[model samples]
Target: MTSRTLLRLAMAGAVVAGSLTALSVPAQAGNAPKTVPVRLLALNDFHGNLEPPTGSSGRMVDENGNTVNAGGAVYVAAHMKALRDANTIEVAQGDLIGASPLISAAFHDEPSVDFLGKIGVQVSAVGNHEFDEGYAELRRIMFGGCHPVDGCSPAGPWKGAKYDYVGANVLFKNPGEKTDVTQSLSANPQVKTLLSDWGVPALPPVSIKWMNGVPIGFIGLVTQTTPNIVTAEGIKDLKFVDEVKAANVASKILKLFGVRAQVVLVHEGDQVTPNQSPDACSAIPGAGNRIATQVDPEIDMVLSGHSHQAYLCRVKDPAGQDRLYSQGGSFGRVITQVDMQVDTKTRDIVRSSVVADNHVVTRDVDPDSDTVTFMDFWRDKISAVANKPVGRISADITNVGTATGESPLGDLIADGQLAATKTGGNAQIALMNPGGVRAPLTYLTSPASEGDGVVTYGEAFTVQPFNNLMQAVTLTGAQLKTLLEQQFPGGPNNQPFAKILQPSANLSYTYSRSAAWGSKISNIKIDGVPVTDTQSIRVAANNFLVGGGDAFAAFKEGTDVWSGPLDIDAFVAYLGQNNPIAPPATTRITAVD
Candidate 1:
């Protein structure tokens, strides 16, 4: 059987112990029976970026307007260890792996797991990106191994993880279904042990944490949107339960087991602010800010990720009561810390009377030795490509838009995806998510008086981060109509984003501002011809979109489905076919006020 430390998965709770006295701060308004002071450190999204990504505009502007360099797992690791040394509990919301750089993703996110372990990531919830390579790979990394596909060493023996991962909502479709290999090899295959031996035995959900001298508990959950967002083939026999429902159920279970002072770590979250979002105790609701309101009352504080936003805002529950909420920005930019003071006498929490903030993980400290070694080992391998210049620029290709809606960078990518699909049948329409573009294009500068006047392969990768595949599918005018309707959430209660893309050329649609709220887009068409609302038209979008990434319920609304290859390959192919390829010679799409 695995030792207790190896089996340790998660924790959530309230406890009174002088152990935290050195790090204890003012109590937050919560209603702890007897407020016992505790310190909690949280981080999310880290996506396994060992080296600082070259062109990321991650340098956030602080209140003083000083933009500082941020990120790199080494700094993150060092920062996390500092918090723990202060007697604080370190927590990670989700997305500890997958969709990372070649060095990490190539190894099935092993480097990330190893780095996180060295830094002491006590517990983490599973996120959607966790399924990037499919369940088989996820199992390999989680249960421990070189992760067969990554070409790691030790040939075939199972290697256990240095940390515990939680999954409250991931369930087997049928009991007695075969588990992913690693799950089977989790404990002793030779001498059998109870199923619960590996944390969440029957159900892949469990809470294991210690607060003060009492065992605190935490419930882990992935979003209900998992099936649509992930590779459908991998999760065929598993079900992703509603996040809210799963959280509620798990909270009660922990309470039943005599564990109180619980917090939830989910791979889902809401609206975020920059590292500099006002130091207000409460957050206003918008796109991703509503997770706090959606959380179960049983949950005290929620550490959420997946939306790639950052904030230390609070939201009132269904009853107008406030709960602490926070999400660290993606790419290891920041580590959020919440200092809660619990009443030593009663186990109850103190309401909004504490300090919760996000701190920058500066590169000041030397990188973690082990993490540095792993990165150094992989750097040489990936540098051959990741660092090489793909193509050169003549003048400049930039998206200097400072507006909030969409950037010129966003438009450029949408055009690129469209260009790739249009080359053949020349797709009539193409859509790309705004979130897909990570950085603006920087033109190369002169050697003496360097200027950001050129774009390179490195710069291009910075713009389109996720390496998803491109998919070309036919969508009927009705599906097209649904695509436009997807711009806003429907019903009295719906999402803030309807998942509509700021599409490329060959497609033109306009909306009346005065039209009833969500039903905005009207004159949508293709080829200057009025697109029949029911007539079918060819559409090209990335595989992530075909599979539904940002709550696009309509893309899947198609009748015939064709899942082919990588979306990035389409881009590479487009550049290859149109060698000496140049950015679009004309502006593709325009949005009117």
Candidate 2:
């Protein structure tokens, strides 16, 4: 951390005493506890997958290949308890609910919230997905007495999470006003009034602890981009305030309360590289964007998430001063630990910097019996429908990426789109986003290897969980070329909203690695013919893309659009009609110059 970023949070000589002298408590512990040590276990985005899934790291590999299990709620509970024997705090970033298995989302966020509460998560921010059903649903899940959503009857284990869910920037139509509401921490009047108008109850911002004689405050924030990324239906009329501005507002408020040593627990992050580089943003891990660096310097430690990446970085703030910043990778794969030293007398942070290290939640240690029990209980309920085979892959649909090409799995999905859209051959090319392929075809049970196994309707829905219907549209050959080039020159980064839409197997193209944004793609072909950059091709894709979702504005330019309903259901129907269809002998998506 740089010198200027300290908020000039200078130590009170009488309060803090000596800096490093008091910080090295471990050395003089024999003299009876002089300085106290506190641990903060922060995590985020556990989307209600109670049980560990297959083919996942489930653990983090350190600098070496050694593997370690990262997390499980029960273990998280145990670890937090063990650490708190000193002065530890347990916290989460956000997205603890929504997009969860049907088991949890069915209950809105109640199950996840209650689950967090049980696991000892003391505080959290509101993730984008938390608003999947809007503020009313959030109220029902967080504060309302009963779980209004389904399967809540059993209430199995989530009982509800034990944590403070904070959303400093989540506001109503009213400005600078507190809505009539109830949450863990205290809130301003504007927040209270807004919640009342929306019929949604919200918790307060910045939970604080007065340890020794010093007060430490924690401010929670969700990404300002929530409204743009979430479904249009979920966030209607709601405003996602600017993250930096909201944080600054809160810091000033905390200042009024005479609180210092502030930490911002936000759900925003930046791209990261290990060991600090041009991309580094302070001592926090799991690198991402410059949000940590760009925010005000009053924040001592910024714990961030939402990118599901792994990085540990430290960056200098606007004043060329440094602050401690870190983020853990998504999934319960890795647990990040940041250690801070506080002065004993004043409870003021004397010599504060941080160490961002990670540990894998490995199965090697005993899985907390309660967590295992709770997880297994829900696993059975969710897997009953989730694990059921949906449809048969008549071919070896695989996404195993080789050099410079697409996978067989990518082709099969593309083919599914084309087949769904080709009522009368209206479309020739099918496109999909690589991120949408949730699971791969099981080697033996898939459609390709027939052993009296048939594709079930359930299996197909699993592949297309987004429920995007297959649609066909016509574009001029020239306009189509522009669309393909757009993916290249821009890639996913050139345009902040860009999403890589993987083409179906029926298409082939060669894109250069060196090409600039909006121009990388060069040669393209479909069905044994070279495609002109400006030439159009009839295209098939899920409703999400065809409607300009993920910022694919080109699809909107198509002259004709036709819907074939949900693609997954179409896959199931196709399997029933074509029981023995074979996988294409050649992989469809390829590269060329």
Highest-TM-score candidate: 1
Give Cα distance to truth, residue 280, candidate 2, Å: 12
State model 1's lDDT. Answer: 0.60
Model 2, span 279-361: residue lDDT tens = 13433332234567666776666778777555565667677766666666655655667677665544445434456665545
lDDT of residue 28 for candidate 1: 44
In the order shown, the candidates' Cα RMSDs to the true structure are: 7.4, 8.6
Candidate 2, run of 10 with poorest lDDT = 1-10
lDDT of 1 at 73: 70
Candidate 2, after superposition: displacement of residue 264 in Å? Answer: 2.0
lDDT of 1 by residue, 441-540 (tens): 4554422223344333434554555667767777888777766666556633244554446566566776544466456666776778878866777777
Residue 246 lDDT, candidate 2, scale 0-100: 69
